[model samples]
Target: MPVHQRPFLALGLRLGAALAMSSLYMLVKLVHQMGVSLPEIIFWRQAGALPLLLGWILLRGQMWQLKTTRFKSHATRSLMGMVGMLANFGATILLPLAVATILGFTTPMFAVVLSALFLREKPGRWRGLAVALGFAGVLVIARPGAMPISPIGALVGLASGFMVAVVSIQLRDMGRTETPLSVVFYFSLVGTVLMLPTLPFTMTHHTPLQWAMILAMGSIGTLAQLLLTAALRYGPVSTVVVMDYSSLIWTTLYGWLVFHQMPPASTWLGAPLVVAAGLVIVWRERVRARAAATPPEESAPAGRVPRGR
Candidate 1:
């Protein structure tokens, strides 16, 4: 493909991926509003998704490619991913879609901070400033005065953020040892297993319509990850990172259309901060890329800790 065409393809793929993910959130919120507990919603949604992924493996004739040498890494990553997605979905149910979406993008910031602390990677001055500013913005979004905080909702978002950071860490380690698709596929499988123990408590009253919604959630989620993976394949990581931010736009629309709910003012104020955090990461990444474009002055670090992809 031509260079110009590549970006256009990426744009379209990101847009579609955004729509799928935002729609999954919207649907989960709808189900929760209809009286499903968070546990029940998570169990059914992920369980429904498993067979669809199985179908994809069969269709692609790549079932053999599902073999993974990094089972423990995938298992750990999947557990964290499960926690992240459940909390994320629950947050969507309790809060405005836009607010949830905006705060959720803080994943990258959390990724940076966690990487620095755990991976012992140092951030340059500008990136450090960006991380601090982003956390202040999180405070703005979580203010006690306006829109009294829901502890469950807040915890959901924060915990999910941390788990997602862990997911990125595992990905970094495992990406070298396994295929990306294999990693993603296994994450979904492990997530379904992690979500299973709750089934007895989760198996509650559900109308047929609700079941359909849950299944749709699973299908959409699988589709969303596929498109996102494809989008990454098509262009620069920075472009895909920027496009990931567009989920807020889709979630905002979905929130209003589905539930007539609008995010609070503080969330609106914090949106720029979240975006700025991602932009900072992207900028730092570009700087690193340019450095890599040059011959190194000395020996390079081994498996250098990366900014959240």
Candidate 2:
């Protein structure tokens, strides 16, 4: 209730939620480092998530709320999500989870540009600068200037960012017609379907412990998303976003301590700028949302009509 500390407190919540999600990413990287194949990783993790997601909805007795009038759009969204997952996982293997996430946060920046170009939504000036800055940050981390680069990790990051943006835009349009539960069900359904083709290709030699880790990856992601949704019900989004900064800290620590994988100093320097780009995008979007929600100022006509004529 203290006014002065509100920003501080809100920051904590978002950071905490972000950290929770980051831990999931860390687990993925660690498991993958143990030499698990991407398809196998995705299969176990996403499959593990499905039952828990359904169970939670069932607990709320909202399972029947699922619908599918926009099957095409739902399928598109899910495909985009699957691609994003692939790129993201590959990035995790190529770089530290924290570094990949910093690169991944470019999603919001991509969303801004994609929304402008495709949806005809005009973003503010700051978002434009953020996009450029984000690219620069990528250059810093990728070392395009001084050394040979595979471009695979960078490409994967960009691809994941792009696909996620498409999915987000799809959701924006899809939201006008689809119920949240319906959309969620479709995402799970389509993702499962798309993932099926790759299932036969996945490494099937995971030990029980690796399977457990994979299961944890999927389960925790679903739970974290749910918890984050719950957390927002109790607190403001700005607080939650700021709290997400904690993910950076947790992921960085997890990547360093557990993996002993450290990035070049240039990467460490650029990461803050990358993260700042995400924060700025989130802040700008929140401000825009608030402005849009505020009713336009009303003015009496030059000549007022009689009331209830």
Candidate 3:
């Protein structure tokens, strides 16, 4: 419970969460390779998480907290989340895991732009520069003229990040009044319901092993979200956000081990730019937060000004 230890605990939790999420992405690719359609895979994913979320709400006696004052906001947020999920799944099917994972790191970059546009939260010089660098990194990985990987897949991954950014803005607005559990519960519920129709036609019979992998993928996803949330709750976002980049390591390992695919030179070269950009954004935000937390000289009451002045 010590203040100093929280950062260490948060870092570990974020690392674990990143590993679990990387595993989930790899599982999605596995199921896609197994011939399941995207809709059905998405349906199962949402369905799998639904139970865990609902159980938590019920067990915590927090069902009353699930009530939402902003149904429209929840619906909008869920819609954006579903689209992001679709794009993410598509990227996994189309691109190598490591490449897709790295591209997804652009979420923070896109979030800065979107926050300015929608939330009117303007980024300072450092974040603006970081966003620019992030886009340049995307260009390096994408390489439109002399494509290293599937260009379409790379674009889809970037699009997914943008969609997630949009959804984050919505969540930020809703979080003003909504409980965290309510936001997650509604998103899971909505995503499941939205993808339900495809289940009947797209669901194919699978072996017991395949079924287990599918379910495990969904369960691991739920666990990943829980760990990520807990990490943010315990430590500053800057500390925890940096740990998310560890997904690149996990995904690269998973790619090599499971699919015998290693990232090309471009990924190795470009990923650092993107990761660095994201870290800059986090650092800038941390500086701003600390600045806000400290009182200005003029705000000091009476002659209480320190001798440092």
Candidate 2 lDDT trough over 10 residues, lowest sum: 1-10
Task: Compose the digit string of candidate 3's lDDT tens values, residues 115-191.
Answer: 68878887877899999999898888888888789988988999988885676456545545666667777878899
RMSD of each: 5.3, 7.1, 4.8
Candidate 1, 1-309: lDDT as tens digits: 222227678778878988898898898889887788888877767677678777877998988768866677777777777877877887887778887777777767777787688789787777788888887777788885565456567667766666655665555455455654676688677766776888787678789998788788878887876676566555555555667788888888887887888877777777788789878887886677666676654325666644432
Give residue 66's error in model 2 in angstroms.
2.8
Q: Compute each candidate's TM-score over C-alphas.
A: 0.84, 0.78, 0.85
Q: What TM-score should be assigned to candidate 3?
A: 0.85
Instruction: Sort the candidates on TM-score, descending order.
Output: 3, 1, 2
Error (Å) of candidate 1 at residue 176 is: 4.7
**Higher-ranked by TM-score: 1 or 2:** 1
lDDT of 1: 0.73
- Whole-model Cα lDDT per candidate? 0.73, 0.69, 0.82
Scored against the true structure, residue 194 in model 2 reaches a CA lDDT of 65
User: Of the candidates numbered 1 and 3, which has the greater TM-score value?
Assistant: 3
Q: Check candidate 3 and list the clashing pairs.
A: none
